[model samples]
Target chain A: MHPAPSVIIFTALSGLGFGLMAWLGFGLPAVSGWSAFTFFFVAYALAVGGLVASTFHLGNPKRAIKAFSQWRSSWLSREGVLAIVSLLVIAVYAIGVIFLNQRWQIAGWAGALLSLGTVFTTSMIYAQMKTVPRWNTPLTPVLFFLYALAGGALLAGQTGAAIMLLIVLCSVQVLAWVLGENSFARAGHTIETATGLGNLGRVRLLESPHSGPNYLLKEMVYIVGRKHAHKLRVIAIFLMGLVPVAILTLLPTNHYMAAIAVLSHMAGLFVSRWLFFAQAEHVVGLYYDKR
Target chain B: MTSLPQSTQKKLGLAIDLDTCVGCHACVISCKEWNTSNYGSPLSDMDAYGAEPSGTFLNRIHTYEAKTLERAAQVVHFPKSCLHCEDAPCVTVCPTGASYKRSEDGIVLVNEDDCMGCGLCAWACPYGAREMDVAEGVMKKCTLCVDRIYNENIPEEDRVPSCVRTCPAGARHFGDFADPDSNVSILSAERGGFALMAEQGTNPVNRYLPPRPKADISGSGQIGVPATALGEETGGAKGFLSWLDKALEKI
Candidate 1:
């Protein structure tokens, strides 16, 4: 995986946005009128803006509408449909709360569930890929869900829940990194298996098909330097998880401190997302003797 | 619509012979030439003449060496293309209904008109068969020469994939595997043709015939016989030159 900037931005931003939406729908802050308007405005901006950024990486972004057609079989299609439906549902709920100061608990809950479902579908788009063994796990969705919930709790200014969620998130994030390191080899994909020549002997690629890099090699056979990946992982955990938790735990509750905490978490989330794509080893690399 | 068909009338595919292929890359070039002109979109090249040139190709040849403790190392030229599996992950993973497998002949294809070029299909494929054309911004892959195989305009004899037709070694065989008596089916049965990455459970229609065991001559007495015989001939010439030098010294 190339860790395209568009996708890193999309997943990180949208995950936070949808998490915030879910919290708002639950009336965590119990905001109304102008406050409700402000919250909804930020949620929509993050969620919708992330969705728009995702299209930038598409080869033909104009035909993205057709992406909603195969929701029955494709997680990507499901993500698209769910994002739009959840956004609409949350929009309606937001209108009622902002305009009339009405708090319909049932509608709010439904919108909240739908918003979370949108994030789940987004995670599935990557998790469903058996070709990338590192991502082909229950842990992928779990990590994604935890990240959303923790980010949401922090953004909604629920310090108590944010501290707890961040602790769980950081622990799971560490666990995922440790487990993911060996998942590719554990999947039993080797050059021998790739070519079905194991019986003959130890198989090794002597020459690639082309002299220059092709689309497959460029997209799937990315090699992140081990030293850089380790450093980035440390930085990501420090900023994304540790900083937010430390800030909320040590400092007194204030608007400025909360803003700092949110910014730190989001920046960390961006780096983690980058590592998520970069470290994934697609099975296709075996043919090229990579990974 | 991205779901696969229950059954295809014909499992049309290629059976490539690793033992016979010389890795001349004739099929690779011929496939590029025929597919670019005949397919929906021409295979595009980015910076073709520049320092970094890359082009979309339907078929490619990879060379590998297989070594064992008992047997000497053997070089095998492996040609790879779309397998058009019964359970194609690529087709099902397409967000748009652009990628599909035909029930008629089991050929996997992309409807470029509906393609969003999100490239999820390419990621799903384990064999790296699908390529996103840089110029067209659409997924391109081996169609098994859909345009040529059934085209009435071309000669009946020419009604096959360009790779198969141009294979100088006759290593590439194209036919329906569904029929028990087809050339591809019989060849696969006799040659122990196997699928690449069978653990993926794609149930690929295409098959590869493994390279035959190479003959061993390491222990044979004839290994250095030629060199020994040449050495004796050279020794005789040296002896005659020494005798001539002695006669000249006496004169």
Candidate 2:
């Protein structure tokens, strides 16, 4: 995988945004009027802005409206539909809290569920790919859900929830990496199987189809990012999991310290998301004798 | 719709003969040439004449060296394109209904007009058959020369895919696999043709005939030089030359 910046930013920011929206819908802060407006504004901005950023990677952003049509079969379509529905539902609930100074409990619950559903659909976009064995496991959804939950908690200022979720998120992150190590091999894709030449012998790529790069090589055969994956993993875990947990636990509870913790967690998330895409080894790479 | 039809009327695909392919890449070139001018949009190139050149290609040739302890190494030239699988993942993964397999002919195609170029379809394909055209901003693939195959504008003899028609080694064959008596089906049955990456469960329509094993020629007297009895009837060279002659005899 190429670890495309647009996709990385889209997933990270949208997951955080939707996560925060879920917490807000649950009335975690239980604010009304100006405070409620502030919370809803930030949540909407993050969620909507991330969705717009996702369009940046599309070659024809003008035609993106058509992407909502195939939800029956396409996870990406489901994500788009769920995202819009979630945003619209949250907007109605936000109106009640911010303007009416009343909690529409039923709408809030529905919005929260829809918000989480949006994130789940987003995660499924990658998890459904049999071509990328490393991401094809149930752990992909688990990791995405945890990141959203922990990031949401951090943004929502739920100190206890944030600390606990971060701990669990870190453990799962480690477990995912450990299990993902042999995922490509375990998938049983090799040059021999890829070419159906196993009966003949061990297959090795003698020559490539072209002298230069092509779309497949550029998009799926990326290998440069994995060189520093080990170092990046430690950095990601420390910044994402440890830093926020340490600050929230050790420091006296204050707005300034909480803000720092939130910032640190978001930054860590960006790096973690980058690694998530960079380290995924696509089965197509086997045909090129890569991965 | 992105959802595939329950069944296609005809499974039209290629049967590639690995034994006959000589790695010439004529099919690759022919496909690029014919498709660029005829398809929905031209297949584009980036810095084609510059330092690093790349272009979209519907078909490509990959050469591999296979070795076994029991047999000599074999170089197989593998040509790959869209397999047009019975359960095409690329179709189902498209967020838009732009990608679809025809119920009438079973040929998978992209409606470039509806394509947003999200590229999820390319990611879903295990064979790396679909490519995003840098210029067109839409996915390009082996249509199996859909335009040519169905067009009456072209000559009757030129109705096959450009790659199949242009292949110099006659390694490529095109027909309906749905009909058991079709040329492609008969060839597959006769040559023990097998699908690529069957474990993936794509159930590809295309099949590849494995290369025939190379004949062993070692110790055949015709190829190996007869060992001479040196220093028996004829006087052999002494010193370094004598040692070289002894080594040659051992070989």
Question: DockQ for each of the predicted structures, in order?
Answer: 0.69, 0.75
Cα lDDT for residue B222, candidate 2? 34
- The model with the greatest DockQ is 2
Could you give candidate 2's per-residue lDDT for residues A1-291 as a string of tens digits? 998888998999999999999999998988889988888888888888899999999989999999999999999999999999999998889999999987998889999999999999999999999999999999999998999899999989899999999999999999999999999889988888999998888999999999999999989988886889999999899999999999999999998998889888888899889888889988888889987
Give the Å error, residue A46, model 2: 1.2
Colliding residue pairs in candidate 1: none
The local distance difference test score of each candidate is: 0.91, 0.92
DockQ for candidate 1:
0.69
After superposing candidate 1 on the true structure, give the runs of residues whose Cα lies further than 4 Å from its correct spot.
B220-251
lDDT at residue B8 of model 1 (Cα atoms): 99
True contacts kept of each: 0.82, 0.87
lDDT minimum window of 10 residues, candidate 1 chain B: B228-237
Cα lDDT of model 1 by residue, B151-216, tens digit: 999999899999999999999999999999999999999999999999888999999998887777
